[model samples]
Target: MSDVVLREPAHRVSPRAVPYWRLSAAIGDAIVAIAAVVAYVVVPGMPGWTIVLVLLVVAAAVAHVVLMPRIRYRVHRWEVTDTAVHTRSGWIGRESRIAPISRVQTVDSRQGALMRPFGLASITVTTASAAGPITVDCLDADTAREVVARLTAITAATEDDAT
Candidate 1:
């Protein structure tokens, strides 16, 4: 084992926890609504836009039914402990991921047009790993900003030791 120290205080879970995909669906639902109308009006034959629309709606509904249940939307919690930043997600296959406080390279937040109505943003945490970045979506914007700031500070302090 090696010695490592924490530079900042741990963050607590947010109180306004919400579904991660609710926001995505908010946008997708709008598009689906338009598609539904188009399908109702434009389908010319027995196997046409009507069938396509039904498939799309069914697909979207099925996705929501299957995935929404597995996501622990109400239980989202994240904390920046002394040694690592821990985040938990999922409802059925509940997953927990930890990034060593020192291994964190970047933390960013993104805001979309639909997210604005919900006053939310998405956060992404990146490391040197090759699997690409991990994203945490549908966070209240302020919380997203706070996470980014905390991670950025931690990164700055440890940059010199980066390989």
Candidate 2:
């Protein structure tokens, strides 16, 4: 078998993605904070140390809410070339994927309820790899559509069975 090498993708996600990621992180952090508060309130006669723990949790949540989005914005990137699609994503731990055009099976785009407000979308490219589909998140909606169309056309033109 040949060795596989990874390289950085050439394009960054939409600038608007930063706010979208911030909002997403904020929502999840809010849920965690609320749960911690509720647990602290509902559990009476809790140890004093538990209060410290709750405070620590809230603090961590706040930090994640504020910092993660910016980190992710810097980390996330994607590129589509004539032969392959490359992507880099995640904040805490980075991931990179490359899918050759000949191996592409399908391309799909999605806009969730939260994404609609931000005019953001995600594109998923199914390939013949065992690692599962490659997804590019927080793209501008129109860009996502264009990417999907382009990938579809490219894959359609290929002679492979995508096996």
Candidate 3:
């Protein structure tokens, strides 16, 4: 990290990702929170503890829906190189990763219902490293495909071919 002076992620995720992330998080949060709250209300005599728990859940949902997506959009970024994959993301506890293309095990792209409408997709690169897979979130669908293709070629070219 100290050797390379570059400060920011080489590529920021697509802007459309903000709304797409926000919507999906909000929907999941609402589904769980609303269901719990409704169940509590239907009981007629809501217990004090249940009410407090539900309220706390709602508060968490509110933050998850409102704050997280925006922060993620601002922080999330990734770059693919002939030698490595670089990424940075998260707010409370920032995380960054650098995975060499030679170690990559798999490359995949996915489109969720909400993301599809916005022409967005996420790409994940699994590697042999113990650190965990690296994800490039919220790229333009076409861009994600390009990244996958480029990374695949780079990784394949570097393979040792044990067999």
Task: Please provide TM-scores, in order, for all candidate models, with all chains considered together.
Answer: 0.62, 0.94, 0.85
lDDT of each: 0.64, 0.90, 0.86
TM-score of candidate 2 against the unseen true structure: 0.94
List candidate 1 stretches off by more than 4 Å. Answer: 1-23, 30-72, 91-94
For candidate 3, the clash count comes to 0
Candidate 1 accuracy as lDDT: 0.64
Between candidates 1 and 2, the TM-score winner: 2
Compared to the true structure, candidate 1 yields what TM-score?
A: 0.62
Clashing residue pairs found in predicted model 3 = none
Error of 2 at 77 (Å): 0.5
lDDT of 2 by residue, 59-138 (tens): 99989988988999899999998799999999889898988999998888999999999999999999899999999998
User: How far does residue 138 in candidate 2 sit from its true spot (Å)?
Assistant: 0.6
Pairs of colliding residues, candidate 1: 70-91, 72-90, 72-91
- Model 3: CA > 4 A from native: 1-6, 49-52, 159-163
